[model samples]
Target: MTAPADVPPEFLDRLRPICRELPESYEEPAWVGVRWRIRKRTFAHVLTVDPDHQMAYARAVATDEPTCVLTFRSPVDELHALVAGGHPFYKPGWGADVLGMVLGDGVDWAEIGELLTESYCLLAPKKLAAQVAGPAGLCC
Candidate 1:
């Protein structure tokens, strides 16, 4: 897939390595920005939300400026705690397991890496998923 012109190259630079490490994962251009997938299932998607066009994300974050956003799947048990904090995180008005995060200053790349790993595990086929280790430190 061609690189998405809307997403900042720097953002792709940070995300590409983490997604690449997963077995069988690949990058593709999404309708909006870009998405990383394990086979056909998307685990992580990044897009820039312009309040003028995307009201849902703009309202969710309550920001007037264009904001870069990353959406991913989170385990149900951890969803509330992550979104409850609010600022950088929010529940998108879609899938039960889907969550959106505002990406900008002070964002944690390490945490993003861990979360993306978990997201990949959740969507990838069982055999392929088993080939890669889960996030560091916490247990299933």
Candidate 2:
């Protein structure tokens, strides 16, 4: 996918709080990546090795990356809106070609928590199974 052009106003409105609260767990080394961290560890990233400006958010760690890269189904109208410039990224787990599902700019903070919770659940160590916020009450 190419860089995105328009930032979704509604999505940003809801994403700020989660970004504020998710980073409270760290006081030592600090997390890695561009933005968004959980307990001082990276949970989301604006920078990427991917050339499309494709951002990544945690959806369960895959390989060595802290978060899975965002991907979406191709040929969708929302993605088509980003022909010029915008932050290009997909919802992790969905492939790079899928276009209908765009992540980063249009999601709310509660949704961000929900998304992170899901990712944490996916990548979370088996020992933290009960502690990691998965699907139940992540928004609260």
Candidate 3:
């Protein structure tokens, strides 16, 4: 699938390698940005154009700088702690199981990679998840 026209190439350049590492994950346009999905389930989605999303994330993150929001699945128990720990993340209005994190300067790519891996494992089929899990163990 082609990268969404609205998504910045620089962001995609950094994101592609992480997403592609997951088994059977594919990128495509969804809503106003891009999403990585496994079969029918979307494990990660980006919101780059919507003003409401931007404002909400900026408010949650307490930053006015232009930033892209990446919403991804997290373990139900870890969701609260992640956002509460001042990690530049928050819970999306959509649900409690998913969390939104601001992606911009000073972002930790290694952590992002781990989050993406966990999100993919959560949405991918068992066999596929197993293939990707390997030595990483289940969700990080």
RMSD per model, one decimal: 3.4, 11.0, 4.1
Stretches off by above 4 angstroms in model 3 are 1-5, 52-66, 134-140
lDDT of 3 by residue, 49-77 (tens): 33445565557556554457788998888
lDDT of each: 0.85, 0.36, 0.75
Model 1: ten consecutive residues of lowest lDDT: 131-140
- Candidate 2 or 3, higher TM-score? 3
Residues 1-140, model 1: lDDT tens digits: 12322777788899999999988999999988899998899999998888877788788778777888999999987878999888788998889999889888898999899888888888988888778865444322
Q: What does the lDDT come to for candidate 1?
A: 0.85
Off by over 4 Å in 2: 1-43, 48-106, 135-140
Error of 1 at 92 (Å): 0.6
lDDT of 3: 0.75
TM-score: model 2 vs. ground truth: 0.34
Best by TM-score: 1
Which residues of candidate 1, in runs, are more than 4 Å off?
Answer: 1-5, 135-140
